[model samples]
Target: MNTILNFMKRNYKILVAILCLSVVFFAFNSNAKKDNDPERDKLLLELLTFVIEKGHYSPAAIDDAFSKGVYKDYIQALDPSKRFFLQSDIDEFSKYETRLDDDLLSKDLTFFNLTYDRLMLRMAEGKKVYKAILSKPFDYSIDENFNTDYDKAPYTATAAELKDRWRKQIKLSTLSSLTDRLKIQETKAKGTEETSEVKSDSLEMDLLDKAKSDKGVENSAPKTFEELEKETRVSAEKSLDEYFGFMNDLDKNDWFSVYINSITSRFDPHTNYFAPEEKERFDVSISGKLEGIGARLQKKNDYTEISDLISGGPAWRGKQLESGDLIMKVAQGNGEPVDVVGMRLDDVVKKIKGPKGSEVRLTVKKVDGTIKIISIIRDIVEIEETYAKSSVVEKNGFKYGVIYLPKFYIDFDDKGGRDAGKDIALEVERLKAANVDGIVLDVRDDGGGSLSTVVDIAGLFIQEGPIVQIKSAGRKKEVLYDRDKKIEWKGPLVIMVNSFSASASEILAAAIQDYKRGIIIGSKQTYGKGTVQNVIDLNQFVRNSAMGDMGALKTTTQKFYRINGGSTQLEGVRSDVVMPDRYAYLKMGERDVENAMPWDKIDAADYTIWNDNAKFKQAIANSKMRISQNDQFKLIEDNAKWIDSRSEDNTYSLNIDKFKTAQSSIEEKAKKYKPIYEYKNSLKFNSLPNEIDALNKDAILKEKRERWHESLAKDIYVEEALNVLDDLQSKAVTTKAMPVKIKKGKLAKS
Candidate 1:
């Protein structure tokens, strides 16, 4: 024993050395870099060890997949929406030294299998708990304590009759997603059907006859598919009102979407998920080739209301279509209309949308209480609407150049080609060539596109300076400056914007306003979304994998701001000239979204301001007089009231006496409008395109519009803006004011 102990002691130093060496070797083998992030590497190692021990094994055997494979798992865990971890995307992400996805990549099968299993188990448990709670009690206090009262005093969906309904409802919703692990397309139908059958039993026609009756589709009455559909839609829309609550139907496909979305959001607000349709439509929409009614429509529950009229579109051309009108029925030309009141918004849109020049008639319940057949010829609206259109407006005595910048235009297909900035430069050249005193840039509902175009547009007005700044994750903000000393159109500028102007539009408007280059007039604030999203087609990444192509994803990448920091997420841009709009009664603009990116001002950049804006103000004040007294402005205001009465919503009492009284009031207003031609063309929802022309008495219409535009020259807001521009040119001072508020900004743009 002594001899053995002596030998052991003698070799103890060597043995310890060997043990230390082994430890060092393993550490080196698993060492992640420390130049940027050391803590991340340590967590990754721990996760690797944890995963290898208990992760489920696939028949294919991913026990010791490559570190690259492991990395993918971590990425997916971080963003399970499958946003960044595309197979093709891996190649690009791999190029980065320390990918953000490293923490998300998984090293073993145990992690994936175990997590998936646990996830399913948890989901089942959740449903069980929800079912149990819902079955146990009924209370009216649910609205007050739903946020905190899941336990103890839960609200129940459980009357004997309600129990069966609750079960079915839970079955469809909770189980619809469970039938598949994720929200993926269940069937591709092999191929498209050459001819789809439309039954002569019109779903739309029957609903309309019912709607015009008393007690308009009550709760107990929602027995049919259509009725239930309407109720579901109504429920979905209810969340949109007051304070936005509840997850969107798309996000509720499965538990994973909810889980992944929350997890990744902790790291940064930009990253998010994309459903299959979101990905598909991402390309189709921007490409501008998708079959749509050529109008900007939005779903607000069972009601799909017109968000914006795609200017010069068939709906706009039909002239009867107005924002806030609810589409009730859809019919192909001369066919009986289908009441799509309770249908999915997208499905209804599909029903209404078709190939360009084809006719789709909408049974529109105008906000003013009139139900009319407004037929429109769906035409491919030109991209010009998304660009800057130049017009010469003489407000009061000053003839100012008016350029309507609909949105910050960008063509992604041309990213590798021509930049939209150059196009804007050309448009500016047109305005400059027109040489009409000062300029008024009207950007009412422009939502922004293309960073390069935004930068380029800003540069066109200013000689050159920092247009914007981008701050990457945990990195110092880098300024993107316009060093080019070229000015496309540097005349006194007046920028007209509404609550809907956002992103690139906000950047441009803010920059111009900040630089003292122009005045912004319109809404109280703009849609303050100053973030950027990158289109990620997951199919590109997983093309060779089992899923083939999952679809596309437009993931938020980063927030953009003026050279001086100010993210316009919840707070949109404020206008310089105020105008009254009927929509103001509703909660409008940003700051309405829950947890929208907060507004903060950063350090201001240095720039030179030309002190020559007095004349623009002088001209504006002078124009206001003409506008205030102008016959056209008076007529327009009167028409707004007259139109408002006709478009009155829900107040339509289906009572015979009320219906006739309302009809008489509508006819009276239509006659008193003073324009003889307005009455000649009766706007009915005709499915026939050839018949649409009769709605407008062309020559008289042109004469009236020209007269209207001439009157518009004297419009209080337009005239004031032009006068402001003239005053600026003459070196005048006009205090800024607000304009109309657009309500969509208050809710999730999803």
Candidate 2:
């Protein structure tokens, strides 16, 4: 979801120069003498404001307009559902709306203090309101409605009105759950097996044997409507209790982070502050590796529940820890087990996550009501989904390769480690080894990562050329070029993109399109994010600071443009062959943001458009004509329109009969589009020889590849991309150049 700048060497030098000047100024003035929470907070505000003002690519003027934007965004973020603060609280808070800019300039904390304390009070009151409403039986016969359009709904004026609002909301939830349970019971009574897709929490749990063993399977037997109704209320109450428990785990710093982000985001959607823990998570996300047991945990009231295990990690390989298992105690090797039942989830994670090769034992309560201890040797686990993977498919007696790059991943710490560029080159080499006729590089849902990787990847298809242009404020534009003259694959190439493809993804797609080296296919346009960001460590500016881990700031430092001199800021790359998308009617691109940067153009870079493919234009025309007459695609277009029409239907009834009737009508119409998910392209996707050998040894990897290949078989978009590749096939033998050296100076296709 972010782009890394290639000017790290220069960027850090610039930061050091500005930060030293700020440090000298801070030494002369002493506003908050004491080293307390408030003092550290004030220092953070000072450092954050100064860094962004000096470092941001296009720093917005900190005027009344900016203040108002922060005020609205912060208030909305605090109470997005409008279930906490009453109208009076908002009225009082609105007085300082335009004065936040002045307060920020003066380093004042009046507005933040007042709002944070008031939010705390309101949340305590909200806990009571929900508890009181769920304490008794709800009257399903009552004719009432609840609108989920919270943005447009007015806040309640009084406590009584707010209480009534809670009542109707809870009533609608219980009524819906009650009806689903009733249907399941009816199906059971008719000697028919109940469907696993029921909406009731307790009923859904019944499908798992673990639930039957722990909660008693007898509970799933046909129950009276009264019994089901009461259970619904209990389930609703338990969910609220768990939610409040999670909220209570958040200390003052967590809320302060939220408040800080509201201000930072006003400059741009991609710019924000990251706390210490959040920064660590961001690093893991981009690098796709972490040293731990590699299991995701969730806080369920008192116990830490194992949500899912990373496929190739220690826990997954151990084959002991399971999804429903609850960790009761954690202990280091040969150390006494420490109780983690009532501990915060973060604290539990801190206990479990350790250096690589360390041993940790966990005493877990199995779902079958048995207590057992399991030991695991922690190691560096690579998230398989984050890397690029390729699958080969046979179409019309020719082999085609499909490579899906989830993100442009890179390990900033270890330059020699795996990255998107290195992995993609290896995938291309593997596909070439398999004698593939064409290749489809799918970048769908890829939000983007390292900017340098885009250049390296785009270089694989073409000889030497500029891939993208980057511009800094008040500076000349710099064109990033691939100097390597060797091409790995000289076959038909197609780049697939959608609305979610952004930043680095856009840069790659735009370069390929401008070069005429590949045909762009998928959604009408991409996510329209053309900005570059650099994460600055705040601790580097402060000397002898008592505040532990000052965290980091990711800010927009530049904007990238296509080699054709066009900015993908607002108008992302338009697909050569457009496809229908379900969320097309929604405002989802960078242009949808209120304060997004405007689009502009620069001088085009000197590059030659590839003219080797003779049937490139004919392939595009053939695919467009085929899509126009396809029945499945027409049905997809109709479904997209139908989905858009239903976006505004947010209100639901509390009356049981009315609610059920309305839901039935919607479900009946939805059944007509069910075939969309079931549609298969009848293509067989397979792994290359190397991957097949690895998959045979690793069962987990085998299952993952099987699932991925199955998904590719059903993807109609991929089917079309393959069709385009088929049409682009040339009788003229392509001049396959020698493979160039990849990242880390290793020749992958030598």
Candidate 3:
């Protein structure tokens, strides 16, 4: 989701000069009485359009086609479920569809102003509709069905029709919850405490509790069907109330961001406008670190509640701050406490977060109803989930290392800070020290980050080579290379990817595949995001203006390609060994995106393939043969086909009996694939010595690692990856009967 570019240093002067020259004709008048600053909005529109037009890799013409695309996307984003806007409202909005291009050019806010005002009005009416619909109990005996295909569903013509639509929506939700609750009761009556459905429901409820901090139904005693049905209504009402509460918190600025994004995304799917707060969040996500107390807060009605704590955060270590606790006030150091109750969530967060080593004191009402003040020293909290983690597993008399990179993270401001490339190199060193026979680099769901990190990570497996090719608009392709001669991992290497793997992930996979340095496994192809984006801070362009923050823009500035000349754009790197995925047929990749950049090829980079991996071809053949004959894999393929067929099965019966029967049939059919989750391998995974030491100190960290290791034990794909690694081992090395030298416990240098 992030890309490498030091635009602040390299392109700042040019951008500012461009903005200064372009803004001479743009005149704005302030309206202090307006809800949103009209002058600021106009300036922002002017700045955004000029910046994108000049910087984008291939900017789309701001013509009628672009205007139409923006109109469709914006309207859909505003009311995706088609519950807020009426057909009459859409008819009125359609008048300006093609005229939006003129609005953008002249910085006219006519379309945006009309739509924003209308949406606010409609949303206010929608709040009334849903509340009234949920107020009355839905009759489950009615022989009716509801279609969840909101995209095709026509907007209601009148208030009466809208109410009926809302009723069906609410009824369907409550009916599903009612069925789940009734099933739990039935299972309890049957004395079946360990049913998979029960376990799944329990997990779902537990997750909801953590997310909402909602005190769920009181006691575990079995309830009558009537009581369960009422509970379902209460749950649905509470969920809708919370959703509307969040909607109420959004201001005109937030809506304006959406409107801006609708315009930006017309250039490409990845191009987006980030508000100031959103920009901060994007930075945290890319860096995987933040300067805060390390506790996540959510608005619960009028109170700000602690939802979760980062594992290694100051609040977590303090132990006084806990999830479900409500914050009443926040004070910086010994300053006077500010009442944060009923305040905006963003304002509350601003009050709570401070620079590292600063102290923030919070007055909180505990879950037990006792009030207490807890002072926490804010520090740099690294999100463990963002970093690459490895587990050493013993399989077939050899230790194989599995390293999972959640994303290609990097701290752009800090050159010495942790990045995917460096962390991966450290993991390789650790695995080598553990005497691992081979390594599996898992980037299954990695959406990618720093472009530089991809080169660094890919370089670890090869001695020296051109990693990837990059091409900007109207420019010659530039080849990025790994000039380093030291290969951190020269032994058996396998890179695991899925359809979610994208951008820098595709680059790494394609590079390794091109060099024949490692085998690429899993998914038919990756997420197919080949374009690179750079975040442009808009505040830098304006000088000393009272317009406040202008936020930032992330736009596609270049396209990346594999060393073999082909762009990974829509045709993401094809796997060397394809695996059956349940969601394989889902239209979730970049290729499915309507406005995605087209795929094209360039001249190949000059590089020699790694000739040392003699068993690579045989290993791939052996894996294919094993997977072809495996019953589990065959079942997985069948499940995939079943899932693809069921993708359109979005309608459900409203009658209680019919719903139960349909669900029961599904549960029975799902039982056939139960082996997928239950299957466990003989291999046992363990943490490295350093992680083991840290795990012993942190119970939360220990639990996370244990769960991950357990999941790895149940992963058939990982087991197959190990099988490939087994086949990939050099035969001559094994025949020599040479003992791997060990210095005490760690493996000696090869």
- Which residue pairs come into collision in candidate 2? none
How does residue 546 of candidate 3 score in lDDT?
65
Q: Per-residue lDDT of 1-750 in model 2, one digit per residue for the tens?
A: 799976656766887698888886553224434222776777788888999998899999999999999999999998998888899999999999999999888888888889889988988999999988887888888788899899999999999998888888778777887787677777666766645434556534453334346666654555567877887888788878998899888877888888889899999998999988899889999999999999999999999999989888999999999998999999999899999998989889989999999999999999989999999999998999899999999999899999999999999899999899999999999999999999999999999999999999999999898899988887788889999999988789999999999999999999999888999999999999989999999988877455666799999999999887889998999999998877888789988988899999887777766757578889999999999998888888889899989998999999888999998888778878877888999899999998877898888789989999999989999999999999988766667444433322222443
Write down the TM-score for model 3: 0.94
Model-by-model lDDT, in order? Answer: 0.49, 0.87, 0.86
Question: Which of the two candidates, 1 or 3, achieves a greater lDDT against the reference?
Answer: 3
Local accuracy of candidate 1 as per-residue lDDT tens digits, 270-307? 34444454543544434333455667777765677887
Cα RMSD (Å) per model?
Answer: 20.0, 4.6, 5.5
Better of 2 and 3 by lDDT: 2
* C-alpha lDDT of candidate 1 relative to the true structure: 0.49
Q: Model 3: per-residue lDDT, tens digit, 1-750?
A: 566554224354665687778767666453333347888888889889999998889999999999999999999999998888889989999999999999999889988989899999988998888878777677999999999999999999998888788888889888888877667657756887644554334434654344344445543456677776776777777778888888888999999999999999999998999999999999999999999999999998888999999999999999999999999999999999999988889989989988999999999999999999999999999999899999998877888999999989999889999999899999999999999999999999899999888889988988787888888787677778899999998799898999999988999999999878899999999999999898888887765356778899998888998887889999999999998888888898999998999999887766767767668889999999998999999999999988888889999999999998998888889889888878998888999998988999999999999999999999988988889899988646443322333232234443
TM-score of each: 0.47, 0.94, 0.94
For model 2, state the Cα shift of residue 359 in Å. Answer: 3.3
Looking at model 3, the pairs that clash are none
